[model samples]
Target: MEIEVVVPGGATIGEAPTWVAAEAALYWIDIKRPALYRLDPATGAQRSWPMPSDIGAFALTADPPGAVVALRTGLFRLDFASDKLDRLAPPPFDPKLFRFNEGACDINGRFWIGVMFDPLTEASPPLKSSMHSFTLAGGLRPEPDAAELHNGMAWSADNEIFYLSHSQRQAIFAYEFDPAAGRLGAPRLFASVPKDDGLPDGAAIDDLGGYWCALHGGGRLRRYKPSGAVDCDIALPVSQPTMCAFGGADLEDLYVTSASDQLMPEQRRREPLAGALLKLRPGVSGLARSYLVR
Candidate 1:
């Protein structure tokens, strides 16, 4: 596949690529830079909103016509037009020790977010990160399991399984999901990466139950079958690919976000494309992501 550099300048920690079908634009965030960006693939037009604090992830909301943003401070609703932010919920953990990281909305429109210990801000041993589900009425509900660093978050094409990755542990887990009830069963080992290989960072699910995962620091994107077997592996130019999402008129174009943070000056010199937004045709369509409820 031919990899295209859609956005040349690298983001500090580029992540959470989400496709908005209605606008035909791709939305993403730069965590370290703390900004939200919208890119028009066809016209190469772009717009950005400066965030108040480190932004981990965001999901579009139909009713408010903006987004539910996950920031280091807490969760808030951002009105796209007014550029105003309204508090949705406070950070569950101490903001100094932990911060929100990866997140997305489920099929029922509930937002599922993960919290991770901020190594950049704290030097102590990392605390176990937790996952939470949020709704307009029910608010944030914490899940039982915890990981050192939570990253990948996606649902199977059928919505019968939930996929989550523990980047520090180099593992991706699968859980039986009940879309009607918004409940998760005990997690099973879905996939794991070797220590030499890159940790699984963020992921997207194709229509055929294939999970496309970006191997941060590995310089590759790997696709796995629903049965936990490797399907396809595509090499990437950047060594720190943080996330991938499917976009385009047919949803076959794969957009990847990479990170330029935490690299030494020499390393940065070696990786010119380290933080660029990349695109390629993966030859498979992806499922539409659900918008945040409320």
Candidate 2:
């Protein structure tokens, strides 16, 4: 599988790219700058939206013509057509202690979002952040357990398994997922990379049921089997590859997003493509795109 560069030169921290099949567009977020972008491959057209606060996660709703965003305060709706933003949930308790990070849509159209530990409260022991799931049923619940820095999240093809990452810890976890009940089982350590290796950020599942994850600081994207074995490694030009997803009509074009926000001056100088988006052509196709609950 050969990897190519796409949107080749700009992104501070690109994460969570969702494919909107109907419109043939890819929607992704840049957490550092807190902006949203829609890229149309056909015309190479890219449009961006500024967020009042950092966006942790968001997804395109299946019924409605907009996406749901998990913001610093709470959840809200972003109407792409009208370019309007509306609040969906009130600010959570301890609003200042947490902010949104990674988000994705599940098989049931629920949006799962992660929160980053507040930097202001460093003296406090590292708190275990939770992965929150929003259902069309209209309620928010912590899926199962808490993570130090919950990042990438995705479900298996049958929707029975879930994968999550703790970025700073350099580990990924797997759990049995029950979509109907919106519940998860106890997590077992999935895999961990050495400190010198890149940290796992965002990931997506392919049609073959394998998961492909971008190693944020590691400069590569790695694929894994359900058993947690490394199947393949695809290197990238950037060191901060944040997320990757399969888009394009055939679902074979692998689009990856990277970042530059936390790079040291020296590292940035060495890797000018640090924040650029990348594209790869893999041997396997990806699963169909999931939609968010309206």
lDDT tens readout by residue for model 1, 1-294: 899999985799999999888889999999989999999888999999889988988888887588889999998888999999999899888788888888988988888888778855647887896788888788889987687788889998788999999888889999999999899898999998997879899999999999999999899999999899999899999999999999888889999999998889999998898899999998899888775564
Least lDDT summed over 10 consecutive residues: which range in candidate 1?
Answer: 118-127
lDDT of 2 by residue, 1-294 (tens): 566666765677788887777788888888768888888978889998888887878877654577787888788888878878988886453566778788777777777788777654455776776778786568576766577678768888888888899887899988888888767877889888777878888998999888899887888889998788899888788888889888888898889998888788998888888878788888789987676673
Supply every candidate's count of residue pairs whose N, Cα or C atoms clash at under 3 angstroms: 1, 3
Which candidate has the highest lDDT of all? 1
Q: Pick the candidate with the highest TM-score.
A: 1
Model 2: pairs clashing at backbone N, Cα or C within 3 Å: 56-100, 56-101, 198-218
TM-score of 2: 0.93
Candidate 1 is scored at a TM of 0.97
Point out where model 2 deviates above 4 Å: 120-125
- Superposed Cα deviation of residue 81, candidate 2 (Å): 2.7
